[model samples]
Target: MSGPTGILLLDKPQGPTSHDLVGRTRRTLATRKVGHAGTLDPMATGLMILGVGSSTRLLTYLVGLDKEYTATIRLGQSTTTDDAEGEVVTEHDASGVTDAAIAAEVATLTGEIAQVPSTFSAIKVDGRRAYDRARAGEVVELKPRTVTVSAFEVIASRSSGTLLDLDVRVAVSSGTYVRALARDLGAALGVAGHLTALRRTRIGPFDISDAADPEGDLATALIPPAEIAGGLFPTATMDAEAALALAQGKRIPVAVTDAPTVAAIGPDGRLIGLISVRDGVSRVLTNFPNSEEPA
Candidate 1:
């Protein structure tokens, strides 16, 4: 509860669960109030947004941001988990799967579409994780949900024997699973398919290129609350009295339009909270304690 409060853009290495990085961040920063906006599988590596201290309140806003990933989809073999980490469940000769046909199918997968998440995913069923039930040998049935795939472009292709591997870059909305895309792509092309590699490149305004390795200096890597909020939402500068009124849970008069939420900055240029405007009146949606003060 008492430490540097801000966001930490971490480049998570493969083989560690997202939770593992969170734990490591806690140890490095010496704070237990760390939380992440999204998660990646142990076999995946990518940018992970971590909120430290009071910045944990910001995670809720960051979770729904669109994400981008670069991955390899291996055609000719399907796996139980829809990724290379799972056992092979089916195999096919993908050599006959033409590039034009793959491109056509990829086009169909773009835009808004209904998709079923992989059974070995983190989705919860009956208060238990779907993956847990799947590993226990129980059938896990997940419903299809609408998810937008803004872009699904094949960067390169490699063929070996009867297998074809496609390197792809995908931009998708939050909650869209890349593994499922690979699985569905293969199924649509009449061949078995699964993700062989995945690395998230971007999430909203945050990019992997700006992310820091968790093993390095985490304290210095903390991004202040004001900077984090400014990057995500339009900002409204408030005077001392207005900042106090909003902090006291009272509505303040501020003109905001177009955006559903705006970051409220206090007279000192520190983020005070988030506010939403309705008919020119701003109401507090979230309030942050003055980061300069002790917890």
Candidate 2:
């Protein structure tokens, strides 16, 4: 059987890594053309957008969207990776941390602020992943980056002797780290902190509520690229002659104002491709002709 073409929203479970999901999906679909938009840590579980066949081209657009997550922050210990998976570096009594204090610290973290990602992160340092260096027992110093935390609200809190756990929901920009927020919140309260759990609720327009299991036939869950293209950018419907010309990689005289990408629709109402208007001509960014021919 041929490979499935389009996007699949996998409701990723904890334990297995994001790459594991891609490999399994590739085998299940019987195709090698598989890629995921945004990488989730092994401990995280929620919506993961996977692209099958030609839909892999859309991953770039999906990766930069804002994300939402629900997380548990343990406010009594500091971990090497700023999460439960890492070794505890420091332990302290956090029973004194109050709800008012947590809210104040969370407010400081909201909006745009400089955030230093955990050493056990995918960031490249000296041509190597920071996590690799840290894992090898090497000192890793990473610079802080400005990230936007549009929403950071604590839903609940529980105290058990010297330990305190806070449940929070956060909406942040593409590169913002929820683990880092946990770390920072704890630091501000003078009680070391780390993330206990994390579940991504949404990534831009894709939500965990609409996700399917990876163990199932992912081909059946495929969402055509045309279905998503209309939501991402402006659409330009063209005639048969124009669509054919674009399919052949020819530029046509069309005006797409103030938009970097335009969804080109064929006369048959199917997506022709993604295009950019330059010098009064529409140039193809990604082509999707009416034929089901494989690339």
Top lDDT: which candidate number?
1
Residue 247 CA displacement from its true place in model 2, Å: 1.7
Tens-place lDDT digits, model 1, residues 1-295 = 3477888999999999999999999988778889999999999999999998888999999999999999999999999999999999999999999989999999999999999999999999999999999999999999999999999999999999999999999999999999999999999999979999999999999999999988998888888888989988999999999999998989868866735899999899888999888888888899998844222
TM-score of 1: 0.96
lDDT of each: 0.93, 0.89
Q: Mind giving the per-residue lDDT tens digits that candidate 2 earns over 1-295?
A: 4456788899999999999999998888878989999899999999999888877888888999999999999999999999999999999999988888888999999999999998899999989999999999999998999999999999999999899999999999999989999999999999989999999999998889989998886767888787788888888889989999999999898855746799888877777899998766888899864654232
Spell out the clash pairs found in candidate 2. none
Candidate 1 overall lDDT versus native: 0.93
Give candidate 1 regions above 4 Å deviation: 291-295
What range of 10 consecutive residues in model 2 has the weakest lDDT sum? 286-295
After best superposition, candidate 1 residue 36: deviation in angstroms?
A: 0.4
